[model samples]
Target chain A: MKTDPESHQRMTQRRQEGHVKKQAAATVEKGLLIVHTGNGKGKSTAAFGMAVRMLGHDQRIGVVQFIKGALHTSERDFLGSHAQCDFVTMGDGYTWNTQNREADIATARKGWDEARRMIESGEYRMVILDELNTVLKYEYLPLDEVLAVLQAREPMVHVVITGRHAPDALIDAADLVTEMRLVKHPYREQGVKAQRGVEF
Target chain B: MKTDPESHQRMTQRRQEGHVKKQAAATVEKGLLIVHTGNGKGKSTAAFGMAVRMLGHDQRIGVVQFIKGALHTSERDFLGSHAQCDFVTMGDGYTWNTQNREADIATARKGWDEARRMIESGEYRMVILDELNTVLKYEYLPLDEVLAVLQAREPMVHVVITGRHAPDALIDAADLVTEMRLVKHPYREQGVKAQRGVEF
Candidate 1:
């Protein structure tokens, strides 16, 4: 709203210079512990996006699915076949299908074993433990043991854990934590079916 | 916790059956209008993840970046070169940067033109208008005009708009609206630089 256009431009230009300077000042590099948890969607999707970025960068990545089970998803089909990715789905189904406690715990244990291998392998730059938080929530896998493995993994290995009900302890350990808050879901509101490509 | 194992298993099985029944009942099909907003880090990344899904399904996609400008990201390098994607970056830089008002408005206009083309063309199964919310929040483009164009586009085209401060009207129009809530960010708390293959 400044009548003097030159003065307005100068003010904006100065702010940009300050930003550039700040950007240049950051030099520390450390592998991040990232967590995605909440009631909304896109937690695992965002992790998959990072996997794509890693693959694009020519870095090998590992993906382990805990609660999603063997339901074929487009992401699994694509990433599993990619040369740079080692994708594994390790569950019979969701936890609510009578196998809630015992059977689910056994499945989660197997999944964690595979995930731990990928995290410590040193061959991978990133390891995605998809739906691991849900397993942790049910105490299917020992949270302390899982955290120890993550903390002691390869120096530059980034780990992404996603699922609802992330424990307070895990949040404290994470470098970046995003909660995908659900504003509106068609399935809940209008009984809309989970469509292909969008949902899977 | 039920001590009678058979009873507990039967109860859970019944619940799962009910869930399966509900899942099978939904039969509607329609193109989605999705909005990803909030102050969190994964808004754009999730949309890119959907782009990967669309790509995995072998469906062509169109991506038009609004306020991001010409930053060279790993995603751009990946998706731009992919045969199934048509990617275009339009704008100078972030809103706070020098070319704030006048210069930025002109850039937004051209970008909208490209987005409109993709939406109406029907060739692209999905079209992502990245950061269009920020431009709309700044009033660079008339809200009514953008809504009208979105409303009249191809019925089967999935359009995704992402950024912070999404307008209420747009939220009402979208089939899926997710707010990526920022629970924790390392860059803000620890001054950590945006690392390769994660932030970019």
Candidate 2:
């Protein structure tokens, strides 16, 4: 590709201006409450990716799984084994499989207890509440209690919540929220089975 | 969590029915054209997570980055070093920095050529076209030509395209499309600058 001298100079000037603005605008440093929710894939997967990123930075992480218990995921096998990772799976299974509402509520409460401990430990730089939104939506755990613990967490400890149908209260309190809108899903449309590596 | 015998039997029966339905419904197996777009974070991050998942399954992957050139990302540094990954960065920088439309187009074309080669090689199970949507949005590469090549690629070679402002044609062609809607962004709203491991 060839570049003209004038165009190169103009681009450089504009970029410099934008850089200055960005540098000035971005000045805060604190923990972030990130929420990922929608009717699409990659919600938990993205949160796992964040765990990997934090691991890359040599930061300690805690993972509390609320709703995936029937199968062993590759992420848990790989990332859970990492030295800086403290992994805990605390769910009977999906609500559909574990028909007993009382059992599901108990499991969710147990998971939330672990999550609270992780958030208060001050050892973990990041805590991933995988599928906690679903727990919240089902009223397995009270929203006010979750919000209270989150608000009182360490100043620099980031928390990531992932699942569908995040409550309005959680959304309002979160600093970063990404709704994974489903445009197309093969399993829903093409009768495609979830594979081991790709889906798990 | 405790479960009564009656509740357990009922749950097991219901789960058996659901399993039978899933097994019967899921029959197709083929490669997927996945697109992650919109004005939210984790599009590329989610794609990278997929790469990691594929890597765990011992599959080779090809990555062609189109526009992130100015800074070194930890993902590139880590994943590029893996034996199964072929990583290539083929852009000058963002369009705003490069200002020269001709140069940007040429760079994008070169990247597309590399992407096409990776898709046709038959060696990679997955190919990630990182930030290619931005390239397409700028009309740097002809849309029809890109789609044609994608459609013609090996049936089992999954392709992941990530960026914002995806065109309608691509969405229609994709098997799985996730629009990462931006509900909240720390950089834009909370004046939180991008950190090393988090953003990269």
Candidate 3:
């Protein structure tokens, strides 16, 4: 077979291009610290996605929902069954719903106790604090204490805290911070209520 | 507010209604298992959402992406910089991209080695293994080895594996499994390439 000079040059060029392309797809070290901020629905939804992601990958995940005492969430019903995942919720519901400082404090204490253990034990790959900003916003938990827990957490642990009104200290300490501004919400409309499978 | 006998009964009825509502809410637990699968896009995007959710609750996360060599994904870049999170990747592109069986095996070994440490150490609450199914599908790593690692991993770790062609063993072992079926994709019609930020 006679090879044309131009064709031969083109083939060599293509091979070199392939080599470069392979080199370009260099593997990356995958670690993540993500923040879900915004006055919008689905922050928890997004967080659950990560939990399931880790679980699918055979990673351990721990979850604690602060100021969420209702216990009537889809996450609890589903994720709790997984041996790899542990889900806990503060039993304070909401200030608007509870309307009691003592009760909220008790709930916070219960959750805090568990959260502190996981953070210190270095037993999980991911830990989630759903609606933690509410605890900070309400001052139910001391900022310094929370900061200590975060700073002293195991080196391999990835921590995430969510809620409206993210404190300056928490934001400052965060490696990645995102603000999820409420663009538009169905709640703004009159006679509309939080629907199941979407809100709760 | 003058009290009337008939009005009093109505008020009492409303209070009872509220109590019942609260009780019903308390009986439920929110939970989910999201699986990122498909030949198209955004499996990791969905998984990242879960990580953020756990993080918002102040959950610590450990992440590992198998068969991915580059340390430049947005999630890794942000998470690696964060002290609260632990991130690790294969640092060697996929076997197809590498085109060298030995190199691919070494890459698999490197990522899995780190993952085994985190899983066994019980250091993370959640771990994400991006494109792990592909590795298993390609047989770059042994099935028994991966299964053993998963079986022996921490009880509390929530592991997530993302990619095409999840194995039966993995599916059987998973507490919750979701198959991200591709109903339609943007790439087929337009021939649009996988772009960073969107696909990576």
User: What would the TM-scores of all predictions be?
Assistant: 0.92, 0.91, 0.46
Please give the TM-score that candidate 2 achieves against the real structure. Answer: 0.91
lDDT of 2 by residue, A1-200 (tens): 23476766686678879887987898887788999999987788778778777887888999999988422377888778899999999987777777767787899999999999999998998999999998898788889999999999899889999999999999989989999999887544578877644576
Best by DockQ: 1
TM-score (0 to 1) for chain B of model 2 = 0.89
How does the DockQ of candidate 1 come out? 0.55
> What shift in Å separates residue B94 of candidate 3 from its native position after superposition?
16
How would you encode candidate 1's per-residue C-alpha lDDT over B108-167 as one tens digit per residue?
899999999999889988999999998898788998999998999887788999999999
Candidate 3 regions exceeding 4 Å error are A1-33, A69-72, A186-190, B1-200
Worst 10 residues of 1 chain A by lDDT: A1-10
| Candidate 1 C-alpha lDDT tens digits along A1-200 | 23245665777788888888777877667789999988887898889889888998899999999877422388888889999999889877777763557787788889998999998878899999998998888787888999899889887899999998899999998999999998987653466677666787
How much is the lDDT of residue A90 in candidate 2?
A: 91
DockQ of each: 0.55, 0.45, 0.05
- For candidate 2, the iRMS in Å is 4.7
